[model samples]
Target: AVESEAEKRDRATREIGKRVMEGWRILDKKCDDCEVPMLTQGKDDDKGECVLCGKGQKKVLTEEERDRAVSEIGRRMLDGWKLEDEDCCEVCDLRMCSKGDKKECVACGPVLPPVNVNLELPPNFDFSDPKALEALLLQVQKKTSTANQVPPTPALSEQKEVDKVNISAPNTPNRYGSNSNNYPNTPSSMQMQYPNTPSAVPVTNEEMSMIGAEQKIREGWTMMSRAYCDCGGPMMRAPNSREAMCVNVHCVNSCY
Candidate 1:
């Protein structure tokens, strides 16, 4: 097939870009707007350019631009940490500097801690879906309602009545007879006697936590049963958020 004018022009442009960036180092980073591969030049890789788009960076970025770039980089990184580029070493052109009175790059001086980024929703989050939005809102409302709720304490008379019932329940006569000793005073026996009534078992702190986690799992808020975190730990979905976190206490990123 004969090459169209537009195709020929695009091919020519790519060829020209290749020649122009022949000696430059190709970076793994891509242009945000063009989605084209970027290349860098100079002794410290300070200069950057897109092969196809001609978008180049020669001068230092402004404070706002630097901050925005750091956020963008953090979002792209799997480590979930943002970098400070305010005083990056000119020698390495990298932001591996210690955040002190005087920032120094580790490659040339000292190590710096990366700032942790906020937990973001999963990549598959869809804001346009009405059902998903409704579910999220409902979860938020449920949590709010639970937090604001205060259990009403029993009055002294009510407590006395409850105590009386508890003391008399065991002595109450049954078809088997009061002194028959046919049943023990165990929970099982009580359950047998009052089969239609619900048991009021006192839940421990640990058991309560487990029950809450199980409830979330039942509501399809967690994927722990089907999927594992990167650290080989069970993953639970964060409340009111699409983010999933490792449930293993020993895992370094468990809190995340």
Candidate 2:
């Protein structure tokens, strides 16, 4: 069905109003270049020119528009903050930062310069002043006196008492009795009790010489017993005498 002329006129008027609103809307790209608001008009031959820059540009915006654009960029940066390459460096074995120009480990990021976090010095640490030195000395003396004055604890005192008791206690005879002999100098008879006699007994020259000979023979036997074959078997004594021999001939020859 054909529309009436009055309806068509009203539609054209509405279209004109929409076009006017669109003309007022700022364009971001053109506004970035211009420091001020721009007047825009649609023409058949060319798009438009920035009133501030006079650069024939299609997009233009005001200061508020520029701020919005910067904010949007910042938001995008925050949202997409990530390492550019998932690929780790072969040498450093760390993820690279996503920033294109980054030269160091991007994911782990470059190590910041070490900050000196040492506490600031007090304004009054002068050592040259005799009064200051005297005050410090007094503090040190007080601390030393306090440490020295800390009495021996109960446990320490008890331990000292125990030690004193042990020192004062009389000596008791061994289980084998005073005259039970072991080495050459030990007494031979447990019952030959003397009231105040010393525990040790003197040995005769002949007895001492015999004991020395026995000890030498024992040591020699021990040395010969320790000799072993390549197969790790012990040396054995030969049939009739004191001489020892490794059973394996090869071991005996090598060992001897």
Candidate number achieving the greatest lDDT relative to the actual structure? 1
lDDT of each residue in 1-256, candidate 1, tens digit only: 9787577556634443333323344455666665655665332344467655577654455554443333322222212232353656444454542323434332333322322222223567454455754454454434434443444333221222221111112433232234334224222332112222222432222222222233333344544344444544445676578777754333446532
For model 1, the run of ten residues with the poorest summed lDDT = 159-168
The digit string of per-residue lDDT tens for model 2 on 83-105 reads 33355432234333334443333
Model 1: residues with Cα > 4 Å off, grouped in runs? 1-13, 57-256
Native-referenced Cα lDDT, model 2: 0.32
Q: After superposition, how far is residue 106 of candidate 1 from its true place, in Å?
A: 18
The CA lDDT of each predicted structure is 0.39, 0.32
Point out where model 2 deviates above 4 Å: 1-122, 153-256
For this target, which candidate reaches the highest TM-score against the unseen true structure?
Answer: 1
